[model samples]
Target: MRGFRRGLHRRSLYHRSLHLPPSPDAAHAQLLALHESGDANAAARFLREKTAAGSIFPGFLSSVVIDRACKSGDLRGALLILATMLHSGTPPPNQHAFASLIDALSKSTRLADAARALELMRDAGIHPDVVTFTVMIRGFCKNRMMERAWEIFQEMIKSNRCQPDCFLYGVLIDGYCKELRMDRALELLREMRVERRIQPDVVIYNSIVDGLCRSNRFLEAWKFLDETMVLQGCSPTVVTYTSLIRGACKAKKMKLAVRIWNAMLERKIQPTIVSYSVIIDGLSKAGRVYDAYRVVREMETLGCELNVVIYTTLIDGLCKSGFLDDAYALYRIMKRSGAFPNQRTYATLIDTFCRNDRTETALGLFDHIRDYCPLDVAMYTAVVSGLCRERRLDDARALFREMRLAGVSADTHAYNVLLHGAFRSERPEEAFRILEELGDDPGCVANLLTYNTVIAGCCLESGMVLFYEMRQRGIAPDFATYSALIDRLLGSGEIGRAFDLCEEMLASGLSPPSGVLGRVVARLCWSRRGDLAAKVIEMAMAVDDTASFSLPWDDEDGAAQDEDSQGEELGSIKDGATQEEPVP
Candidate 1:
């Protein structure tokens, strides 16, 4: 430690007897002046050079060194300076100095260093005050070290040096509740009330109820909010109600959420925008658009300013609940009411319209909103998807160009949508070109779905090239990739290649369509290659033991029996594969 070496240096300087000030008062006064001058290093050096070692130095002066070391961005240096003074039997360092050091170390996430500082504080004969203990406890809790925080709390009580206050209790309780350990949180709350006569406040009550509700203990949470906290004269705040309403909505109990909302009103407690947002989202998701409408109207009645989220959420609900016309009307109302709509607001309206096969309406809405809010990829992607669904490829392409010309880059999903449209419309070459252009555009990150589209859109040759590139890029092929390529190979009479793909598909933990492998097995058996037939059939049979999973296209039951019976069935199958009824 620098402090240890510095201590040795100070001891050596003690015997040197350098020229000095006439009195310790003059020396101390000079030291204080240098300390306040903000050149802490010079002060420390002056202290080491002039001050007599093994003498009773003032603790406050040493503490000034500690503070300057901490402020100078040298934490270990600060701790070392404190250690050197304590070891030298200097006057006890001030509690405020220790508290400051602890706060710095704890906040920097240097918990171990902070703990060492605590031990040094004790060695200096200074018991930690409430502020010091609270800082340590808060640090441990903030780092999610609940166990250590509990240990610190127990240590505080055991020391009898400081008592835990409401703020301290709140910190630990909040930590436990956030970790979803409601049991520990409640136990502490009960102790604070019964053992210490500390009345739990609304913030504390809100935490427990929020924790319990999020834990899906809806009955327990509601009982606590309505009975336990209320009877104790601890009123629920808007934050408290918002939690319960959100919890109720998550539990799909829309009626209970509404009840909480109404209960808040009856108490003359004003609900905030967040409170309205939670219930509105819940009611709209439950297909009760009109109920959500009532809440929105209530906001208007109370002169509460409507934001885009409230409007978008309500409009989405209206669209989802089959009140599309109402959704459009609300959009109109939102605009006329002077609340500027964001891209999300327009996207909701346009997306819902497109999803409902109202592409023309969606396009109209898109054009209308363009002059107001800037266009985004989601807005264009939605309409592109809708147009592609309607097989309006030319219009979709035109919009795609317009999107880039407007300085908005198309995302991966947007490119995937356009490629899929092209493939569906039998424009394979166009799809390939689009995929090539997608690769050239660094902004796009093609996922597994993107590759699957390319594979399904191409011939075997181009598909094989992409499949290799896909593997080199570390994208694993899925059933769709194998299905498309294997179908193409099979149709072109590439039996060997098709069989290898089937084996690969099976090895990849995906079942090749039973008919594809079964056809190969039948053909091999027809050719009297019983070994290959048995090998293929064995893999199929391992995957399909139940009758429901049997090869219903032909008689595949005989292969499910023992070896001898299987051979007999195969021989029969071979015989049935005559010229009139050739093997599929």
Candidate 2:
């Protein structure tokens, strides 16, 4: 029967049923061509018109069209075709047809629609098989709707329509693991193993192991792999070791990661490119660029083809470690090796160049990649920040406009960068303009950083006004906000106001920056407000005994000598010396 069906599919069933006189073979060929050419719309339109015109499509042909639509990411169109097939009743929709549609819809996050399609399949007297239910379960788990997924699993078991399998258990376990619900995931794993007698596969073990690592339960992960996995006869794959390496890197346990890498090699499991990439990235981020390069060389020696991602990781690591020339040299090597640098590679190099006072070089790189690569906000932010750091406000402004013109809207970070630069460059007017621009756009709500940046730029009076305005907008002042205001007040000689701000800072349970506090105390003492300075120091120490106060008067005996000097200064003010001479 299968051979007969294949023969029928091979031969054109009909040639001239509709206005168009093309055979089914010719129509199918045209549809496939359209799909391959990336014109899914034309393909869908052609299918819909043929179906609407009473053209009889073979069951195989309908399934082909449906599969193509789903593969093209046209879930809506695929569902429509399925609906048309069911309505026509010429070629009844099979499990494969419904499964394709259900899988696509579920993956697309239209879970409810996928459920509806499942009901339609059942109503048409086609019972959904295990694959159908698995797809739905995976979709729900992926969407983080664990409750719904559990209900589906329960229904599958209770209804006896299809026995729950290891794959189903694996899906739910992975979902729980991803949500950091390791306990539930383990519970399910136990139930699958002991109760259902389903041996957990490597995939399930990998999921739980990865979950343990990600949740920082590395000890348990290690124990499970060493003891439980060995007893259960499940061998750890490269993915399992890679997960361990990644988790170790995240926890900054590079020594442990290296040990795991060695163990993987001892087991004779060849490391995949991803495993190499993980180690390289981890080492590079840990300031071990030379070690990362050695791994790259080792990978090449083992005859592993170097890809763009590995090169990009090394480039970024070198850039971060302040080896711009080395990073650029590798980049040139990568290009010569026929591996193109991606946006991240370009962004990393550009950011590094800008940081090292090489804005022009950064700009040149940006211009070179602008036409080829779609510039993301991070790339634009890097250039704008670098230009701002260079105090090239005009050039920064031009680039900001260019970013918008490129259809990439500036995020809050981008705006914050510009606002901070404007304030740092003493362009108060430009900072205010940015605030106004943020206000005009509903999407760009001013965050605390925006307010803090403006306050950091303003004088005492202007800053105070902005602070009150920030409060009126119900934006609470954070540590940065309070610090900025207090620092400005102290610099402007508003000693009393600075103290009041300190009181607010204490009330909010935020300790002022130690350096700023020290400077304020020194300034007060220099201005002959020695009594007030002592009081402020005592207040800060009372609030936080760990607070270190730097006094203008230094003594060799440290605490004892400083205390004696403070007492003498306080007594001098109390003894009718209403004013003391300012320190020259």
| Model 2 worst lDDT window (10 residues) | 565-574
Report how far residue 173 has shifted in candidate 1, in Å. 2.6
Deviation of model 1 at 528, angstroms: 39
Quote model 1's TM-score: 0.44
**Candidate 1 per-residue lDDT over residues 83-176, each given as its tens digit:** 6666665676688789879888998999988888888888777899988898888889889899999998999999987788887888889889
Candidate 2's C-alpha lDDT? 0.80
Best by lDDT: 2
Per-model RMSD to reference: 19.3, 14.7
| Residue 119 error, candidate 1, Å | 2.1
**Tens-place lDDT digits, model 2, residues 1-584:** 99778656564433232235566556666655665567766777777777777776667666766777888888778877777777776576677878888899998899999989888988888888888999988999999999999998888788788888889889999999999999999999999889989999999999999999999987678788877886788888999999988987886667556657766665667789999999889889988887788788887876889999999999999888988898999999999999898878888888999999998999899999888889998899899999999888888889999889988888888899999889878899988898788788665888888888888887778888989998999998987888888788877778888877877776666666677778777887888978867876776776675444443222222433122211221111112131222110
Candidate 1 lDDT score at position 523: 61
What lDDT does each candidate get?
A: 0.77, 0.80
